[model samples]
Target: MSSTIAPRVRTLLLLFLAVTGALLAGAAPVSAHAALTASDPRQGAVVDEAPAQVSLTFSEGVAVSDGAVRVLDPKGKRVDTGAPADQGANTYAVKLHAGLPDGTFTVTYQVVSADSHPVSGAFTFSIGAPSTTSVALSDQTAGGGVVGGLYGFARYVSYGGFILLVGGATFVLACWPRGAGARSVQRLVVSGWLALTGATLAMLLLRGSYTGSGRVGDIFDLALLSQVLQTKTGAALVSRLLLLAAAALFVAVLFGAYDRRVRADGTGEQNATGTGDTSAPGAGSTDGGTGTAAGTDSTAGTDSTNSTDSTESQEKSDLAFGLAIGGFVVAAGLAATWAMAEHASTGLQAGIAMPVDVLHLLAVAVWLGGLSTLLVALFRAPSLDAPVVRRFSRLAFGSVAVLVATGIYQSWRQLGSWSAFTETTYGQLLLVKIGLVVVLVGIAWMSRRWTARLVQAPERRAAEAVRTPVGAASARTRKGAKPKAGSGGGDGKRAAQLARQRAAVASAAEKRLRDADPLRTGLRRSVLAEAGVAVVLLAVTTALTSTEPGRTEQEARAATAAAVTPQTGALSLDIPFDTGGRDGKGVARVELDPARVGGNEMHVYVDRPNGKAFDVPEIKVAFTLEAKDIGPLPVVPDHIATGHWTADGVQIPMAGSWTIAVTVRTSDIDQVTVDKNAQIG
Candidate 1:
């Protein structure tokens, strides 16, 4: 135990360190987001006259779906600015009706970033009075951080750690009871748990780019939380993952107890010695290990041996191991279930990633976990005997086989073609991993065959076995006295039992004679080999996941979408020529029109085809301009009710373009936008 246990522990630690370092180093960058660029009616400015509108600009494209701005009076009463609309992808604006009654106004804005994250801020300024400049706007944003740094650590370790502890550990259980090239259920369970926990940490930190706020609580905000809950795909996924985790723990408790209790069945019994008993089942029951006599000391025997707590504790570990395994497999299964859902991609290449990823994760568990077991066997086993070596060989073989098979399948699906294996970052990393696995497997196979042959040649080959579990017959003879007097039957029964016991004894000795020793020396070689190989694979897998798949393919998809998108100049428009009452201010319409935007011409029609026949003959036009920032702005004049002629707000300053879109809607034609570019000189 001393010789084998210590080395294996060392191997595990080293391997773990290697994998950790590799993954961290290989992580990629898909992070960038909307930044506040500028605002109209700049913060903390005083003016003699009232401006008609307020607007905000961002560094990148932004959507106003979750965006709003409040202008409050010094008394904190909200002054209504017209509804904000998406003038362009990154711009939002609202108009104020008449002149503002001169006082301070505070403008506060909360906008949703493109990735759906939120940003909020506020500022105050005056219009004609000092009171207007003193208005305080609410600055609290929607998102919440998980609190202090210590709290964040606790949150991640306690919350995120528990997920991996349960998931990875349970997954290991499902992959356990190892065989050659096969991982025990436990290996996968543990890996899944750890990976998930790690991923959660990464998501929290990385989510800022996607969400626009570097806050944990913000990810769970009203808007963000709603998206998760309301989306059919999102809610179902999260709920199922949680349920699977819970159910695994539930089942693990029971399985763990059962496995632990039943585990000693083959080795815990003893036969009465000196009678030369050789029965395979043995004569005395393993219950004797409790040191309480089964027949003679039965009355209070159960109470004295061990306290209830110790027994319960052992049973609980078994339960935990069991549940972790359950959860792990279920996670893998649930991941696959997503592929068949309606929301999943359904094309030939559709739904492949979801299922393939689950399988790939399962393989990672088996390969990595199996490597741990190998290291244990080589460096930690108490005996280097033949049977133990053989047992390990079988387990190792099964693990490797499964690893290779699953890996190939995953590559086929994920890579799309053999060329992708070299072309894409993800595919190339996978190839490297496969290469490492081959090396590890080769080393193990060589050692396995070498030990098996030595067992046959060296009589009394205990060393060949390499940490074999104690045999049943040996355990029984260690029990001195026979538990029974008559023992169920007469002399005939006794003789027959004695005869069987003798045979069992003889067989155990013969087998032991053929087993080899110091199997650790050979196993150590394999364990080190596996450890090294496992390191490389870990890095490869991490790098693979960090990169985007097929950039060219994504581009092709975009190109196709563009082909179907609406093109300009396909539509024409027209509107009525009259200047309605209120002193010649009304709707004026025009046929085919192209509104220039920043020198780029925008095709506009009266909501009709560019070449189509239109209604009303002539169109009257009026224009009004509103200048923002850069001055005590005055409203420009306009004539007649005219929707036909474009209004240029070129009077606005602050290094940006202003847009006035011509909306032409007659009793007949559809509404269209003829957006004219306005540059303030």
Candidate 2:
């Protein structure tokens, strides 16, 4: 039977892994959650001239790493002068090299958001004209692949381990004290510990690669490991590892000391050696012993009973109290490792959210983990106590209440708005988890009903036994029996036969109680169903951590206002020219009001190097769309002031990168034409 069941269990485990893989595959990519709301040079804007520095603004605060911001010239060479500096208000700026040449320049950045998620992206802006860039643009906006999958898998395993360890231990201590001596219970809790420890180590090793370049080789890099240890996430993992060491001691005490105590207290049928007593009651004494010997034995037995009743009772109470305090500390510490580093640590009302989240995690571990423990006990224990099931039912109900209350607060804090429920991935996953919880609750309700019936069975049986006559029970047992001829001492022989008949009847009744109890069977089935739904719910919860919170996404969208359209604003350009003539190095400030695909007015103010008005022999302006091979459409401007030129009805026929050429003929012999790029929208 074991061999046949082993294969079926393996197959089901494989199927579960396949389903988990598919769900994880559908999760949002492990990209940084922070959004880039705005930037200096404005993404694709054509600056009149290169600025000394470039700034990026995010929806949340971000930490800059070495070379977090890089500026690349059109030739794909680095032009950034220094590292990025945090300018506050979720803005960071990096200096650029002086005298950056005319062409489009790319700005790439990679930073860690306040929430410990890595953010990376790139943008471009033109200097003089929109020229074709030779810069090789590699996609670095998101980081995730093999390393990410492994990290994610490790996370799921850690959660599973937490549930098993916390739940199994709690079940043994709080629900079924006798289970402390059960091999199945011991193995379940130990497996949880091992799995959680291993998964934590895996996460530690994979963190660098998962967030960096998504390389497998980086997992072993000591340098990367050092870097990881310095971050919040790293600190949390290390703390968890330390707590696990303490948990190891706790597990030892639970299975070793606690189990022995429970068995010694006679809570479990088996002794400390896991063997039942086979000797008949009072068989060790000899009937031929003297009265004094018999009296001595009676006195010793009474003293032993008193010693056990006093000393053992106090010891049990002390041990249970210490275990309770130790377990709470270790469990809360483990939960803190998550709440301190994940979304709960950085979002709004984080001070309140962190403790609430820790409670939420603990409640899940207790309810889901306890359900798993109960299901295993129901199937494997020789004689599962009805009281144990009742205890767990009460515990589960409390856990569910805590889950509901904490879940509502967390949902509101993470989502913020109603529309986000449908618009955001985090909210959708949350909705799925809630639905699973509801289904699980319904299953638990059914299990509770069965538990109630199971608990009442013994009472009902005892009542029936009291109402039935002993003579009737004996007559029923003796039905179809034959009376043998009496030998010497026939009365004694008859008494022995009656005793044997009663023992057989009691044994049969116990068997019937076990095999014929439909309520116990139904409870097991319902608990199993609850555990199954819980596993899926856990998967969804894991996915939610990877996905961006809806509140952050909404905030990002809110920060990123609508772009300025031509109808609402105007385009201005400062074209610099050096005619290589006397007093010819100056700037021409040109403005196109409502620079759209229609007729517009143009104004140009030519200033000398000292910012004073300047008169030129001739000033000519025209626009050309180089991508479309369009000719220079002339915009004839008449000199309206000493240094100002105005042109009415300057029609920009289409929207594109239109090169505006300005010719300032300081003299007939010395003139220069400068081209400035403008995005006409």
Candidate 3:
């Protein structure tokens, strides 16, 4: 019972690994960052009056889909026109109703990036002045809650199913032990196929809902499903279902129908043997009277057994060859569908990228699928095959190597900089995946060592052969000891009894040999532990797929750094003064616009320390290019208000340092000039 149960557990594990590997293989490509770079009325800016329109600019080109952008007033009611228009290249704008009240408003947007990933964000701006009655908009989009989780889980299920369905069958036909086809093993393969099929269909509906309303109830929404069916993602899933159907035919021929044929032939051969045994005595007794009849009967039985064996072998070989060819083509098609719809196909050199991704996915499936099947075989079979284990070890090593190579290319493509490893969320997740993979490899090393030990100890099989249940041993002993009382006389019966005693002694010796081996027990434990860790590694891989790639985040940051990043904008300062005169202490404010080689405005305002306006007799402002031969350009300001004065058309001629001096003459005898340095870029 323990032996029977062990294989089932391992079979289930293999199925699990297959599903996980497949889902991870189809991970969506990470999208570049599409940050909001600029907006009309600017984020958090207070305008003197409400504008007729609101506009937003992103770091990258954005596609407007349903609910792409919304404008909400301070009352949280939407006010922008229903449709948004694209302005220039990356800007989207929507008109506001006439005469919008003076208050804060929020702009919320969700746009699809060039890589087909959604980027969402929101910001707030006010009219007249900053408002206290407005609600704070979130800096980032909200998560997709329970519906999103289900979608992810469904993806995991689909991937695992594909791996198990294809990889498991391939392993059994190509590398499994010749003596290792238990009912449980067959069931495991069938279960995987069914799981993949069901998961594929489930994903179709879930995808529609996820992309549309992102609500759990939308899973059954037909309108969304129809819309989704028109998308690339939907088409790929549909193709997967069709390929799975074709694969089912291959599985039926290879593992199901062929297996039944083989079993039927075996049963026929067994029946022939039983018939020959029952008629043997009668033939011997009548041999003298009918020698020809007995001879013909014996020859016919031999001929029948030989014929059955040869026919069954030939039929199995032919069917297996066909299954292999058909299965490979079908499996490749299934893998292609996933590759075409994922991130890899959308990126650079997609023609080559698609095949590489497919190969990477297939290799991963093979390794994980084989490991799962191998673990089951080890437990179910009495003795492990040295050659089989060695072959699987080599195969696993090759798969890991391929995974590493492909993974490197993918990493380089996504994370264009080393800084992304620690800076981006996607990069951090990748680092975690790498760590887990390393640990899994270490465990695999231990498993390889056990395989080596098993190879060296070929005598282990001889001992395990007799480690059958005690009841079976006792029954065999009884059957061997018993003799026919009325037939063949005492001499024949005595000879048989002596032979039985010898056989019993041999069984006891074999049992003792089995009991002497402790390494066999330890090896089983190690393999099981290794399998546990491999499962965890697969789980981490799934997580990696869901996360955004570091490369995209870095690209987005670079783009934002390019746009909306001013070369040189405005600079201002407020210099305080005291002239040792009554009511003379005041603040002088100085401003420089576009501190560059262009005409700029310089405004000066004077205020008393107690917040009242300070009236000065004269105000003068001047600028001198520092460390250069340029002299000070003085500007006599025209008073615009009681405390405010401005001098327009002030010029900064070159890109260099400059000094601005503001002089406030309250009285002719009490005058002070405040100097400040500025850089023109």
Candidate 4:
């Protein structure tokens, strides 16, 4: 009835968790997914000259994928000299050719995040001034939507199957009731192994396509597969495949030992049953005609055979026990592979995080996988033993405790702040996962309650055993009936009636215990419900694993702050204009320092429609505040450089959307105008 976990069990669980965590840390990647934090030649900046190199800094370490970074000129021509090289833990740099002229050049990048997810974005910067002809980012390098979805699905399958195979086998060997669920348990374990194998193979192919061109044909491309194998992700997957192969061998040994033990026990049971019949008190007397000497010799032979059978059964059981232990050791090492390759290994305080993550994964496998196996047992079992239910209750309690503790730490590490939990997509998804976990825990609680009831039901039946002494009394009455019948007819008739009644009562009780136990039925229902909820929990967990954590998003926003910070600058643009249907062209340049709600100077340069500098008869500029609906302030400019004009002491009130229009007249019959919009801050 005690709800508290025992100190000894708690201590042992903690030790196990700690040791597993350490082992997992050694193989973990020790990083989180990367997000771009800062970039050199900041986006939308008006630089005086092109820099020799462009650099990008991320929230975590990253690997450049194919076509990872490309710098394009205004005309959309590539200008980057080579691949971007990692300058530091989180910085990547790309060199640019000398004397590069740029007008709104775009830098598009695609990199594999530390956690192996693909991330991409584009930004623009200009030399001298911004340009209307900005370069566009290409979609050729982007993964196709359907292929990406398939890859994610494969990842989910791999995780689920891996947990089930490891956890189910471990639970069966270490915790399942003797001689129960032999075939079903083996099938569960084998199915898990097969599922994991299929998922891993599918993932390898899907990953190749996902990281490459995302074409369906790429899934079978040997060239792409060879290239993918060279990367860290591919290596981790390959390692998993090898580990799974070893696990298959271990599983076979374990199962073979189990089969030997079962067969030995079965033979022993048959021998014991045969011996019992021969040694029955009434049977030996009937066989006296065969001769007393012969009977004694037969008994001796049977005794010797029973002794040898007992010894063989013991040996088989011992062998099975040893094989189970070895299997568990191999599974632990295999689980460590996942911890090493996942986000847990790459995040903050990786040494500590990796171990905690491993423990977390271990807890998940134990709870979810065990529940799945238990559910199967419930459905297939005629009558689940109370002892088995009680044992599982304890195991589940310990596993959930570990899960809760590790989950809190991971949430803090990934979210950084409470506000992020509400503000970011990753945080929102995490909340969903947490909510699902809570539901699963509730279902688990119900299962535990049901188990407690089941254990109590047997105790209740023991009390009922005292109330149902008819069977025992009937045996005594039958033994005394012959003597009593000799003494009196009435006594013999009464004994007969009592014997019949006792037989009826005993038969009813046996039927209830063997075929209609209500507690077993209820326990089955509860376990089935818990298993169903666990499936949903796994789905949510998969989503959480795929999501980008809020911490990365926060870092990205901080890194890009400079790009949006307001600064005083002039708006300069070159507009090509033609008037009077002539091939003549003109350029307009506007200069406004402290381009805000204050006094400023405005300048413009113009040429006749022909590519010649010709003084215009008249030139005028107009300003409008579109958002405020209050502008059209016209200003006449005095000629400065023949075709060039200048205006000073121009006033701009209020900071908002503003438009500037320039009108020019080459002669009485030739005139043209152009307009441009700018944000005044």
Expressed as tens digits, the lDDT of each residue in 1-681 for candidate 3 is: 445567567665754655554545434323324566567766777898888998776644666755668888888888888677887536788888888888888888876654334566777889887665555664323224555556666777766767667667777667652422565556656777887788788888887655545578878988888876877778888999899888877776766677766676666676677576646555665456786788687879878887887788778778777877888788888888877876565544567767877877787777776776676666654344567777788878898999999888877766767998999877887898798889888888888887788778777456445544444654574566444456666768676686567667666665445445565555666767767776766776666656666755554454344333434667788888876676779998887776544467777888999878887998988878533335487889889998988888875543445687888788879888888786654
Model 1 CA deviation exceeding 4 Å by range: 1-11, 14-18, 30-210, 215-244, 247-255, 271-331, 334-348, 381-423, 450-518, 551-681
Q: Which 10 successive residues of model 1 have the least lDDT summed?
A: 592-601
Number of clashes in every candidate structure? 87, 0, 8, 12
lDDT tens digits, residue span 1-681, model 4: 012223332342233323323322221121225555567786777899888988886656777854688888888888888788877536788888888875788888877776676667788888988886646555643443567656665666667677778777767665673523367667767777887788788878877778656678788888888977987788878888887898888778667756666676777877776565545433344456755666576678688878888887788678767766776666666566666766776656667877788788878888877877776566554445667767777888899999999999998887888988998777887888788888878877887787787777655563366345864674564466434224778776776787668756765565456445667668767776776566656665665666667766665554344224634677676666666645345666666665654457777776544556767677788888643244698988778787777878876544445788878675677889888887654
Q: Give the TM-score of candidate 3.
A: 0.66
Q: 205 in model 3: Cα distance from truth in Å?
A: 3.0
Residue 46 Cα positional deviation in candidate 1, in Å, after optimal superposition:
34
Q: Which model, 2 or 4, shows the larger TM-score?
A: 2
Query: TM-score per candidate, in order?
Result: 0.45, 0.73, 0.66, 0.67
Q: Scored by CA lDDT, what does every candidate get? A: 0.45, 0.78, 0.69, 0.68
lDDT of 1 by residue, 296-368 (tens): 3433333333344346546646655655566566645544433333212222344454565555455554445
Query: Where does candidate 2 stray beyond 4 Å?
Result: 1-22, 28-31, 139-141, 267-296, 459-516, 561-681
In model 3, the runs with Cα more than 4 Å from the true position are 1-42, 45-63, 82-102, 112-118, 126-143, 177-180, 261-311, 381-384, 460-522, 561-565, 569-681
How well does model 3 score by local distance difference test? 0.69
TM-score for predicted model 4 compared with the true structure: 0.67
Predicted candidate 2 versus true structure: per-residue lDDT over 1-681, tens digit per residue? 334434543353333334554577545365467877777777789988889999887766777777888999999999987778887556788888899899999988877777777788888999988888888766533456778778877877888789889998999889887788888688778888998999999999998877777789999999989999999989999999999999999999988887778666773222221221212122233344464665566666556665665676577768878998999999999999999998888867789989999999999899978877776676666268789999999999999999999999999888977999999888888889888988988988998899889877655663354335444654564454433356458766876788667656665555455645677768867876786787788778778877888877865655454222335587899989999977779999889988765568899999998999988878899999654345598777999889999999986644556899998899879999999998775
TM-score rank, highest first? 2, 4, 3, 1
